[model samples]
Target chain A: MINRPEPILMKGNEALAEGAIRAGCRFFAGYPITPQNEIPEYMARRMPEVGGVFVQAESEVAAINMVYGAAGAGVRAMTSSSSPGISLKQEGISYLAGAELPAVIANVVRGGPGLGGIQPAQSDYYQATRGGGHGDYRTPVLAPASVQEMYDFAGLAFDIADRYRNPVLILADGALGQMMEPVLLDATPREVLNVPKPWATTGMKDRAQNLINSIYLDPDELEQHNLNIQKKYRRIEQQEVRYEIILGDDADFFLVAYGTTARVCKDVALKARAKGMRVGLIRPITLWPFPSQVFDDLLEGKGNRQLKGSPKPFGFLTVEMSFGQMVDDVRLSVNGRAPVYFYGRTGGIVPSPREVLAEVEKIYAGGAGKPEKAGN
Target chain B: MTYEMLFAGFGGQGIMLMGTLLAYAGMIEGKKVSWIPSYGPEMRGGTANCSVVVSDEDVGCPIVTEPSVLVVMNEPSLQKFYNTVARPGNVFVNTSIIDPHHPALARLVGENGERKSQKEKGGGRAVMSENVSATEDESVIAGEGVRVFKIDANRIAQDLGNGRAANMVMLGTIREVTNVVEMASLESALQKAISKRHRDLMEINLKALHTGAEWVRSHDVPLLTPAG
Candidate 1:
């Protein structure tokens, strides 16, 4: 366990690496990529000190495959990359999912479609939450907004991955990756929850030969595997959805955002409140499960009984760093209960707090929650 | 209290280092802080910038679009970011290379109230005075309220026998002006921020910081003739 009780300055990438090592990750393999090169650079020096193995693979595909091998051996392993590099690892991710290997991957995303600029963007939300890999599978994606969350979620991602025996992702952006912040490392040694991997292909010395394979040629067998994976995903969707609602209970409008964009929206929420508008923020910490239940409860006023009969109609403004991606999830969750609006900037352009506050003002003046024009 | 700062200069001017030191010093003082840099292609001798936020509360956006304090080490940086400084903000300019007559620097009228008495007692170098009025094309937008402090940061560092310590000098000046972090905290942060290979430069860096802080504290004393 890392033991710096006082807050220490650390880059998010360095904090993530340290947290993973503290979480008992024994192996890390990653290729260098923009905005995230610090992860591999950090791991190269720190991993050896902790008796963990670190490899700078030839390519992203090779790096992921190394993680696959390490995970197959029942060791906690992880790989990290940026957008284009993450694209190269999709096939390996799919294989890891199909084989039910517990491994963590971090995507410190840059703008994308092709080799987009090495600036922050939320465009990879669909790719991460929807499982960029092939077939009908899901990866639990944890979107961390702060450097502290980047550290804390590294352990959470590994725990979740091990519990489900599936690939888990930490979805971050270049801004979060490159930013430095004060984070409190645990003062006391954390109790690392040692998960027993009974199905691991460790050696069949006395037990029956453990087979780790993803290929199921028979139609019935493949369907059953798919169904079982879906069942696990459903369990995760119910139990593992993490979200945060800030100043939301007594509000008339909500801003839905995650990761880097969420932090900007939070400032906007405070500013809007200061300006006499009741604005709240819904930040989804876990992007995969999408925290739709919170949206439902807030939209229908199910949780806040006092607001049930209130005359004011509440609205949701989904903010993202993408052209529009997570907005779809917000719409799906809102599902016509409340009018959903969106404001976003694409191609690595982060929205200023002023810009978001202006949007909130426009929405507030236009009489929020009405069935209105589609957002830009 | 929250102070959002932007530091911009050429790639090797230690722009990122200035941000890092402030962030680390703030953290040491038990303040929440964040630093984010302009990475990738921009580092190739072009303008490199970093945003740093120090707050009693959690920092919301690490990117500083409306900087409460702006430190520009080059003319290009001052030209590019002069308008982005919030009203009633603080601006620290490295005047060694930049023209002292730049119109955006019209706000460098006098010393801040807190340091004015110190300036009287110390009898140090004089700051720029407002003789010529600013023209419309190059003046700062909504910049009348900003308190501009100009120091020849590179020259000060060079005087200390290391030109690279300009960032440390600037850091000292910022600490003196903003008091965002303690000088002791900055000293300790310097020990941590400097790597082992560069340990020898620590004393010079600290000296540069002290020199800078000294310059700002007594800059209005008119020991040296004011730049025209």
Candidate 2:
């Protein structure tokens, strides 16, 4: 019997560790960095307790390569780091993505325009959502708003990685990494994950030789590989889109945000309603699959019938800490169905509730007059 | 009612422990609770702070901008957090090495709606005591509304066989004054929250908490009535 408590206080990194362990992650390899050190620390202690393998590699680059090795073995593997450290691991990540290996990589981001302060920052929004690793490829990103989501999504990340045969990124910030919240800690049983391993490097004795390689010198062969990966991505786009809706039924304006930024939007949505503004929030849980359909459904009207001259009462406002990363995705999702707007605070500064409320007031008071360009 | 607090001090002063204990106590009482500590470079020696939120309903945002209560163990922490306290809130100050005149001093208002400057009350350069003492005599005379409880957390911790446990003592005092959680529940939570390696130190810390609570009770520390 699994005894699950309602809520238990936990740091975001610690929660991630628990979630990864429960998700049948048997191997973790990573070097330690500030703001995300707890993840590796927790994994080091807990992995052994669960009869798993935990290796603190010499560097982030080596750790990511180790993840590459483990993932080739068709075992659930993971690694974590800050922005600078993540920068170093980009090469390995690109290789993993190319190889079509399932693995989880957590970027508990801190400030960085080249090793900026260790304070929490959303500067990595562009890197995470836009694919930091070198490739004409994309990785599914999950942004968790609270510690509980941190725990829940870590497990989900591993599952999605395996199902899609792609590297999954948990794009969390220092605030989430350092922050602790009550989280129900129930280990998802290992038997629940019936992972198939036709390609695993588990020694080919009674089976065909398994090959896990990203390099394909023949142009046609590489093209075929790319085609297969693109098809998988397309399927992912069709089937996997996750988001949280807050008071959307009566909303005239929709606030779009993710991760810690979404939490602030939730507060503003409440205050705006109290002040008689019909505002709501669409918090994207999965950033890569982008929840484009949700945006389309909201803007184009749910059913086939359009409300005559109602003109889609909802206007999409993208709120992020970066200047305009997620806003581009929101615009693409809306695809001219409705006007898309944006509000952001850069360089490690989080907007206050009052600031967000003021933005809502401005938007309501003839501020969203000019339609924002598609990719701004 | 929801109460959010930020306890800040030097790295070794038990600031994080204080916030954890409050969170544990809130959990024991079935209230939603969160404790987020400072991580990375800022946590080494520069400064350390932790945010603790206890609420009746689900806590939407754990990051606190205007905390109802602020606890400072040093001058830097006092300067850093004083402006973030909500008006009509309480602040606890540790006045051992921190002279009230240190440029990072916090502004406190007494009961009579007048600002009681710490420097003026502490006589510009009051001899820094090894024990915690309230230098806010001017606030008492002026009747400013803000409550400032000063304590020598170091002295309390030493008496408890570990100066680091002063944070727990301060948490006990805050609980007693605020009635945020029951004293027994807080102590039990504290026992569970502390690592097993430090299980032997739990009794002394609990004793320290009780001592601090008794002090608050005996002194009749005025509680901040909840905001309407």
Candidate 3:
């Protein structure tokens, strides 16, 4: 009998490492960065135990290149870094995208423009969703709010990356990276992790040689490759747009948030409802592919049954740790059908629940989330 | 009840660990917890603090603006954070490091505890210790019947032969005061918090906790339950 598992209290970064290991990730390379240090720290010790390779590269750029090399070897590989470090890996990430390398890159983002302090910030939303590096492509971006998601998404990221033959990004912020919560260490067993990769560059014995490079010398060939990547992105957008709509059916106003910000919004939603205000939460799980359709269907009063009380929502208020990066997506999807307001805190400052609630109250008091023009 | 706490002290006093240990212990008890350390220049030298929230329900906003419990291991942390405690809140001051009857140097003004009249420091970040000078006032802030519990955690840990485990001493008082997690879980979490190489110091850590908890139990004035 497979030994029954017991839940253990774990930090988010550690859970990511554990999850990656359970998902059969045999190679990890990254330089240490705060908030994400625990991931590499755990992997350094745990990888040897699992007969996996863990490399502490000289720099973030070197670390991501190591990930590229490892993934090119047809082994499950990953790299992790914080905001500034992630910036260093952008060039490597762009290369991975061009090469169509199936790899997972986790960025436990911190505040930034330039080494902007080591506190958590969701400012990397645009960086993750819209391409961070010089590229005309997209990487599947997963935002995990809790430690459980941190664990669960690690394996899922590798699968998605492999399935699409593209790099995947786990866009976690410092708050989620550092928080501790109860999690099942290994939900996915070793036997279930045997995904096939025919395009991997292994030692060419009897098989044809495989080349892992993003270079297309010909303009026509490069254009064609870009179009093909676009096709894959379209397919991803169609098939995958995961989100959770909590009691938004009856809500006169919807609060859109993700990760740690979503938790604060949930608390505000509860408080606002308790005070007889119609407030609810809608949290997006997948940052890329944007889950834009969920908002569209909700606004149109389509198949989503949980939106019970109101036939349609008044509008959405996007809450984030950054100064309204994801809010643009919310507005793009809502498309003027309903007003959308943005409340955020950038530069490593975390918003309190009460601070978010006060904003919610302001929005609600402005007459059913209509959001009377600014300063009105 | 949601248990929100702020642990504050200098860089190496294990202030952050106190919050982290509570968070871990809460997780062991199947509770939700978020531990957020002050991840700025303040962590470099002068003062370090972290906010920990433990709740049976989901925790929103890991930043505890007005914590339900405030544990101060140093005088600067006490001065910097004293007023942020929620009314009818519990404040644990380490008498070993902070004088009970001390007046803050900076003149008090607005409601938000923003101190004015400060000199430049580290690119104008306004170091908390430098902003507030000392006074000889004998008015005790953590006096009787105010829900402020004073304990000599430093001395308690020193008595147990590990002065670094003063965080554990403060944690013991936290267990007794908050009762957010079980004592057994706290003890086990403390054991795990210590590195394996220092297993020899485990006994003394436990002793320090017990001693601190005993002092709180014996000295703190009874807390009146807030009526719903």
**Which one wins on DockQ?**
1
The order by descending lDDT is 1, 3, 2
In terms of docking quality, model 3 is acceptable
Q: Write the per-residue lDDT of candidate 3 for residues B64-115, one digit (tens) a residue.
A: 8888788888888988987777754677778788775434312221112332
What i-RMS does every model get? 0.8, 1.9, 1.9
lDDT agreement with native, every candidate: 0.85, 0.78, 0.79
Q: Write the per-residue lDDT of candidate 2 for residues A268-364, one digit (tens) a residue.
A: 8888999998787889888888888766666667652222223355577788777778888888888877778788876667777777778778778
Q: Which docking category, incorrect, acceptable, medium or high, applies to candidate 1?
A: medium
Model 1, B1-228: lDDT tens digits are: 899999999988889988998899888888889999988696787789999999998899999998979999998899889888875577888888787656667534332232335546653433212232122222121224566766778888998999888888888988987788999999999899999999999999999989988876764321212323
TM-score of model 2 (CA atoms): 0.88
All candidates: DockQ: 0.68, 0.50, 0.47
Off by over 4 Å in 2: A1-6, A187-191, A303-311, A367-376, B96-106, B110-145, B152-165, B220-228
How many clashes (backbone N, Cα, C below 3 Å) per candidate? 0, 12, 2
lDDT of 2 by residue, B52-146 (tens): 88989767667778887888888778877776777556777776546643333323442221223433455442222211123333211101235
Chain B, candidate 2: TM? 0.80
Higher-DockQ candidate of 2 and 3:
2
Candidate 3 segments whose C-alpha is farther than 4 A from its true place: A1-4, A187-193, A308-310, A367-376, B104-146, B157-165, B225-228
Which one is best on TM-score?
A: 1
Q: Where is the poorest 10-residue window by lDDT in model 3 chain A?
A: A367-376
